[model samples]
Target chain A: MFDSHGFHQTAMAELAVAAQVSVGQIYRLFKSKEDIIEALVHDDADQWCGEMAEIQMRMDAGELTIVETFEQLLLHTIDEKDEALSFDILAESFRNAAVADTIGTMCQRFRTYIRYFACAANDKLSGEALDAAEEMILACLFGLGHRSLSRPRLSASSAARLTAEMIVTALGGVR
Target chain B: MFDSHGFHQTAMAELAVAAQVSVGQIYRLFKSKEDIIEALVHDDADQWCGEMAEIQMRMDAGELTIVETFEQLLLHTIDEKDEALSFDILAESFRNAAVADTIGTMCQRFRTYIRYFACAANDKLSGEALDAAEEMILACLFGLGHRSLSRPRLSASSAARLTAEMIVTALGGVR
Candidate 1:
């Protein structure tokens, strides 16, 4: 209903009718329409955080390459069949400050993970080179994710590989 | 009203009050709230198109470099101060497939302009080199635009300069 009618169009009365209950029933469950939307947003965030945590654990165990970690992340974000809750939230973030704030926090958290992975992958780098490497990785991840939304046919695996190669190449040019 | 309360939150009665007329007056002026929003969007788009057309004319006349063209585009978008409109519409887009359709059309138009500018800037490029250069420019423009919303302090001029440098450096690598 939210997807079809939007946040404002899906009123309490309509929700009641759709759920086969009275408006009062909805009030008893959710304080307001905004509350329902907040709940949905929180649920989506939790799911994404869980996925990132799992990836981080695998990386910590030294079971995943930097390339494999990023490929999984991109595939998780852009694979057509996946439930892209983060992507959905990001698309709407431009409109909703709350959504933007949530996504920003998530991005920061992801950046830390990317930085750690980059350092792990290329242990020889430090200072400016490492920072530039981290920045390029983040940029590529963000760029690829944005492009995938518009061009769904772009292979997620290939995109991730290319992004990894580009970051390495770009970093090499920094010094 | 749409900036603060959002499209759905702004009641017809409030608009009528703000316009100093009866509720019927608003309906007479705009068939629906969506119509009002569309008008606003069209007006903003027209303004941007006008500015971009002027910039294109100057570039074609050899009065502006590719870097200058990019700077003008970025500065214009940032200076508009209609971030709210873009945000609101983007949020609405996720819910309405029609919004996505509109965005895709806009993207194609922008891509054409990018290609034109790129061709003019680097007349010697051909084949894969041309494709990569175009892709890099598009990515930089769109990626930086997306980032600008979160980092408003990052002036369009600076971003454009950085983007121009990055694209030139990337192309240099390819060469």
Candidate 2:
């Protein structure tokens, strides 16, 4: 419901309609809109963790380079549903600590995965160096995701090329 | 109104109430909700262009490095209202050609500004090389902006340090 109508636009009545539940039933379960949002973020986080676990395997096997993984992540961020939900959660996180914690946890999970592969590739990429590189790569991924929305016509190939180069630079010229 | 409630959540009735006008008045001004959004995006683009002009002067005066300018831009993306509105507009652009055009124009303006400084710094940093650097820097800026939303406690100083380092790397170590 939040994905379809956005978190702010998804009123309890609308949610009840979408979920095939009585309004009274919703109140019986979730305390408020915030409560529903919190639960949703938790649910999404659990699923994302599952996805990350698989990605970790690929990272270890060298099935996909970090740049390729980031490209895929960026593309996911551009998805209409994913981007909207993410933007809403991120915007709400500014005012809601529960949401903030959820996002922070998700970010840490992603960074850990990236760091795992990055360290394996270059032993020197650790500590603050690792953190900085991860941050840059993540930022680039996030930026491209946002760009996907504003510029639907934005060339994925061009973005991919520049981002790959950026990842190399951030990784201290390791490819 | 879009900034506060997002594009979809901000209804005509609420806009009338906020703008101190009748719903009829709004309908007369804009044929539909899409028209209103289109107008808003275009108006915002004009204002953003003016800001870029000022930044260009500062760039010429050597008052701040491109990294510093980017830091300020990154921080603007972190602004609760600014980021929300931008995210909303960028998201809307995906579905609306008018919004997409406005955003493309806005992006071109910002890129031109960055290209000017970049070329002045490194005559070789023109064409594809400059385009690549600006894209990376913009992506980094955009990424940090989203980070600010997700991590409310993220320190500006730390973000600045990492981003400045990123700018140097993106410019091919041109600092």
Clashing residue pairs in all predictions, respectively, total 1, 0
Q: What is the lDDT of residue A120 in candidate 1?
A: 64
lDDT of each: 0.59, 0.65
| Alpha carbon deviation, residue B168, candidate 1 (Å) | 3.7
Model 2 spans with C-alpha error above 4 angstroms: A1-36, A62-81, A94-97, A115-131, A152-154, A173-175, B1-40, B61-82, B90-97, B115-134, B152-154, B173-175
lDDT of 1 by residue, A119-159 (tens): 66667756645544444454444555555324332355655
The number of the candidate with the highest TM-score is: 2
DockQ of all candidate complexes: 0.18, 0.33
lDDT value, residue A103 of candidate 2 = 75
Off by over 4 Å in 1: A11-39, A49-72, A79-104, A117-172, B11-30, B53-80, B94-98, B118-143, B146-160, B171-175
lDDT tens per residue, model 2, B120-159: 5456665555666666666776677666534423365656
**Model 1 chain B, poorest ten-residue lDDT window?**
B147-156
For model 1 chain A, the run of ten residues with the poorest summed lDDT: A80-89
